[model samples]
Target: MASMKFACIVIMCFAVVGAPIAQAISCGQVGNNLKPCLRYIMSFWGSVPGLCCDGVKTVMAHVQNTADKRATCNCLKSMVAKIGFVPWRAKSIPRECGVVLPYEISTSINCDKLEL
Candidate 1:
């Protein structure tokens, strides 16, 4: 029983700690708007592509919780500015799943990783 209580406390602490970090990640792109990876890809190479931001928007449109939804929106928007594209394929990333990609896009995007 004592160990269970300690574990519960630890879990609660982690949850509290994580909430702000998630907020911080989403804060950077607040209101910047997302760019479609398709258009962004073309734009990088050069073209007046129509709104490609839709792809990411559609991917995340269902996120509930007004604040978290906004934060996640920011995260998606950030993806566009940083890489000029969205590479995640999926919009909202869960804590458990890994992002899979065929290419090594380290320098292309997130060359400067914020200290996590």
Candidate 2:
């Protein structure tokens, strides 16, 4: 019984500590990765720059799970809204990078509607 209780405590501790780190990994670092894509996302360019595509690919690669993906998507949407990035242009970034995201990238996207 004592061993079982100790194991449960350890599990709980890991759960508590892991969630924030996981969210940070998905949401927090997105802006820095996306910085390279700013100009491409903001205005008409002949084509997305190599650095922008690389950043898009890197951002997509970080989403390891449904929750993380949703969080990352929401973070991207919010950031786009704040930065005045064109929705269609922002939507094209992942595709331009050959990264297929599960949902459309739009400021109006509802994160809860995303499929896991």
Candidate 3:
């Protein structure tokens, strides 16, 4: 009985961990999805238009341990960047990703500013 229960637990764990990570559509209704993040960066960097999409993408890409987590985080972060005419609050984006958002930041998700 114990062995059977253990097998069931393992199966459940696999099913939970094996779920596919959903992808996000880039600012479907907005222009140049990077604009918002860039805009936010601009305000901080003396209104300079160059904000660094590559840096943002890299930070977002490493936000997770798995491919799914990376993809999902990337999408959510991108959305926030685009929407943030000003900087965004860290608490907002995590809700979209269904994550608790540890205080530690990853490579691409440098949205520490509460500018929004």
Top TM-score prediction, candidate number: 2
**Model 2, range 13-101, lDDT digits (tens) per residue?**
98888856433355657888778888877887667788878877778777787777788889988888788676678788777888888
lDDT of 3 by residue, 1-116 (tens): 99999999999998889977745333342224334444443344433223334333434444444443444444555665444434433333334344354432233564443221
User: What are the per-residue Cα lDDT tens digits for candidate 1 across 1-116?
Assistant: 99999999999998888754332323434333333344534333443233434433443443435555444544544544565443433232221123222223232344233221
Model 3: how far residue 40 lies from native, Å: 17
- Alpha-carbon lDDT, every model: 0.41, 0.79, 0.45
Model 2 lDDT at residue 81: 79
Candidate 3: which stretches are off by over 4 Å? 1-65, 85-88, 92-99, 102-116
Where is model 2 more than 4 Å wrong at Cα?
A: 1-26
- True lDDT of residue 58, candidate 1: 41
TM-score of each prediction = 0.26, 0.73, 0.27
Model 3 residue pairs with clashes: 37-81, 59-107, 59-108, 60-108, 87-116
Q: State the displacement of the C-alpha of residue 17, model 1, in Å, after optimal TM-score superposition.
A: 26
Worst lDDT 10-window in candidate 2: 19-28
